[model samples]
Target: MRRDSVLQIQHSFTGPDQGTKGTLYLVPTPIGNLEDMTFRAVNTLKTVDVILAEDTRNTQKLLNHFDITTGQMSYHQHNSQSRIPQIIEMLEAGQNIAQVSDAGMPAISDPGFELVQAAIAANLTVVPLPGANAALTGLIASGLSTDQFAFIGFLPRKKSEKKAFLDNLVNFPYTMMFYESPFRLGQTLEDCQSAFGPDRQVVVVRELTKKFEEITRGSLADLVAHFDENKTIKGEICFYIAGNDDPSTDESLLQAALDDMPIKEQVQWWETHESMSTKDAIKQVAKQTGINKREVYAKYHEI
Candidate 1:
């Protein structure tokens, strides 16, 4: 075992350590439990020349817990933009740096994007180390369709803007995700219900990975009622809403065909002119003329 390990090390170190001229490593930290920290992540954090953290105090606790003595400086939403040039300078000087968020991935609905943008434009190599993400954890448990989904990050805080945001989703057919604070969860649900209708399905994930982790499943109305009785809610909230079920299609040519024709002739014309499936043409005809689709198909002898 010793000889083999030595051989492996010799092979790896055969050439000069052309250590990255200045690599920006985006490192993901555990959202809740510390045990979720990967071996590589801990090692990288310890060995990196510098670690840019969203919160120095919060990251200090994590570093102390793991016996990692590397230096950490506050680099968050408020200061990331201003700090970008300085960080890029350090990378240009051949220093290896790692960036971490308070929880989960950095530059993901969080600070660190500007620094990344600066690093890229400066031609510095950027490395990504993936780990925990709250959105995915909640999404999988939401019981909503996962084939197609959109992550809208945090919702607008202003009531009017937030309402407009939800209202726009009424016609969207893919599952949607959003992050919300516990205090705003109920209000967000209410807005969603108002826009998407009370019957639309929604799932709420709260305090994921923590002791109070909870996943509530129900329609918009049901969820609103559930939270109303609970009074106080806590922890981060990840919300998922099922997509719109109904869609409206164009009817221009069909409207023209129906203009001067009798119901029977209109239905027949639509079947031929619209070139739609016979079943679909009958349904459209029934909706437009207040006639039963089956009766229309029967009368047209097209059933």
Candidate 2:
């Protein structure tokens, strides 16, 4: 057994030898605007021996734009399984590599996590350079509280899983950020309204730093209405929903909790406490929670 492996080498955190191995520099590229690329980033990309890009074609365009000719090797979800070991081997031989996503920071909702993990496990040097980030970009312009926030990169695709995911954050007290597709914007806004309530303040930023850059801030209800009416939205998206600490947010949660109550309990409370007629109680709940009056009545009658 050749157990004298390179993985056994202790990481030298203090010196010139720290990153001498096959170093993986996590380089951040421009999300939308080309000017966002930093001078250091440009130089690094030019100097690196190889670039592991999420999309070689897109990276090639960027390279062509800046005239940086470092070779690009496709390293995306489908190709990672085969490419990782090859990249790792190259790194082990002291080849400096840079990993980049199509835009923004790699691995934050993009590819590169697996490569980073493998490099770390093998005791290789992994360096990250900060540049454009959609979440932080959206947050700064969101006019929302930036003091405390959570980055919920992307939500689950499945309905049940997505609902459970949003439900889990129903009471989060910090500003919450998310990356979602323009295609699902309407449905996502509706789901968020269902989970966080109509009154919760939310900011939806799309096509960030690009020509169609849009930043709309309002209650979840209003945004839903806007999207439903327009039926047209495009480009990258970063959604910011206000935390549970806000008074309005708290009220929305309380209303949502009441909506979650058993129909029988709700009917009894409305009928007995407020002396409201059955139809009136159903109408009130439907009005307050935005559920269909017929659905509320059916559920109430069933109970």
lDDT of each: 0.84, 0.87
Number of residue pairs clashing in candidate 1, backbone atoms closer than 3 angstroms, sequence gap of 3 or more or interchain: 0
Candidate 1 local lDDT, residue 130: 73
* lDDT (tens digit, per residue) of candidate 2 on 153-205: 88999999999999988888999999998899899999999999999999999
At residue 164, give the lDDT of candidate 2: 96
Candidate 1 residue pairs in backbone clash: none
Model 1 weakest lDDT span, ten residues long: 6-15
Q: Compared with the true structure, what per-residue lDDT tens digits does model 1 show for residues 1-303?
A: 455422112122132333647678898998898988999899999898999999899999999999999998789889877888889889888898999999998889876888887876766677888798999888988899999999988989999998888877787999999898888888889989998889999999988889899999999999999999995998888989998767333464346557677666876676787797767877888888778877887877844
Give TM-scores for every candidate, taking all chains together and pairing residue i with residue i: 0.78, 0.78
For model 1, the stretches where C-alpha displacement exceeds 4 angstroms are 1-20, 249-303
Residue 151 of model 2 has an lDDT of 93
